[model samples]
Target: MHVSEHIIDIRYAETDQMGVVYHANYVIWLELGRTKLIEDLGLSYIQMEQDGIVSPVLDLQVTYRKAMRYGEKAIVKTWIEAVNPLRVVYGYEILNEKGELCITASTTNILVKKDTFRPVSFKKLYPDWYEIYVREQKNENIN
Candidate 1:
């Protein structure tokens, strides 16, 4: 289902005083995962911005499962959970080096005209990308 995996080497700077990765850092990792997924689909957020289109996060949900320490590696698995004309929902799962799930998250993004900040239909803006997501959603349900 169009899943993309991105690996991140945890750095000391990402940890808290107790050496556990800070909760907020997971949110940043989610962004990285989303970016990787888009790039894997042959699209770039930078290029989208250059084209005057922007996707802004409308909602975010993160569930922490375990604590990860600095120096550990994290693999973030991301995919399209759902997509429609007005919004896209991206899902994520962060796993530690031990293969333990550290966090599960999702983000909802709405496409908009960069200058006008008016909502836009992603299907109309990028048919190919929209089609890919639609296919993935179908595949997910089949499995």
Candidate 2:
């Protein structure tokens, strides 16, 4: 599978009043991981936008397993879970410095026309990129 790892150093500002990383910060980390994954695959979100295609999140699911505090680092492991003509599902695992999993999540994104905001099939618009995702999804399943 095409897996990408992104490391995030928990900042003081990301912590809550109790000193644990805020719940919402995980969402940002997810985005970071996703961005890294896309870049690792040799694609650019900026290029997608410049081409008048936008991918918006259709669904998000996150499960917090362990608490992480500031001064620690988080390793986000991301990969493609599934991909089709219209949607791509990305999976993630956030692990603490000690390598314990702190969160598990997935996000589904749909591509659309930037101007009209109408849904579009990624396979039709970007067949090469779509094929890469399909290959990754197959590798993920095999693992």
Candidate 3:
């Protein structure tokens, strides 16, 4: 499945009082992973917005596996879990440097008009972007 990896060095600021990575920090990392995935596909979220469309997260699901301590490197592996005309699902795996999964998550996003915040089918608003995602999914057999 067209997976993209982004390395993140855990900073002390991201930890909680107990010194382990906070639960909410994982969500931030997920965003970084998603951004990296888009970049890897030669697409930019900023560019999409510039085209008068904004993709907003409609849902998020996260599972914490193991606690990560400070000063460790984490790798976020992200991919398109599913892509439909109106909805897109992105999956993620956050693993420690040793390849142990620390967290797993997924998010559902839909494109909408920025001003009106009304849902718009990707096929109608961003045909090229939609076609590229379709091609990627078909090539990777990730339907």
Candidate 4:
């Protein structure tokens, strides 16, 4: 799959009193990776929203592995895990500077109408974007 890489410069404010990263910050990093992936594909989430389709996370799964400390650099690797008419799942791994896994996660989202909050199909509303999603999930040999 076409994985997107995003580097995060951990800050003291992102950590707990023990210097370990706060759990909620990992979720922010996931979004940064997702945004990078969309940008890499020459697409804009703003544009998608402008089209009256809003993507909302339906579920989130996170597993914390090794603890990440403040001042350490984090590399978030993300890929398109799956995509269907209503849902898209993005997978992620947050690794420390030494490439040790710190966290792994996935976010499942659905496209919905901004006005009504009714679920919409990206495959139907945004065919071109849907095709790109399909193509992005095809690199099995990379991992």
lDDT of each: 0.89, 0.92, 0.88, 0.89
Query: Tens digits of per-residue lDDT for model 3 on 29-141?
Result: 99999899899999889988887888899999999999999999999999888787898888899999999989989898899999999999987877887777776552333
Task: List the pairs of residues colliding in candidate 4.
Answer: 1-139
Off by over 4 Å in 3: 138-143
Scored by lDDT, model 2 comes in at 0.92
For every candidate in turn, the CA RMSD to the true structure comes to: 2.5, 2.3, 2.2, 2.9
Worst 10 residues of 1 by lDDT: 134-143
lDDT score at residue 96, model 4, on the 0-100 scale? 99
lDDT tens string, model 2, 1-143? 87899999999999999999999999999999999999999999999999998988989999999999999999999999988788899999999989999999999899999999999989999999999899888343311
- Best TM-score among the predictions, by candidate number: 2
- What number of clashing residue pairs does each candidate have, in the order they appear? 0, 0, 0, 1
Query: What would the TM-scores of all predictions be?
Result: 0.93, 0.94, 0.92, 0.94
* Candidate 3, pairs of clashing residues: none
lDDT of 1 by residue, 19-38 (tens): 89999999999999999999
Error of 2 at 135 (Å): 0.3
Instruction: Give the better candidate number (1 or 3) by TM-score.
Output: 1
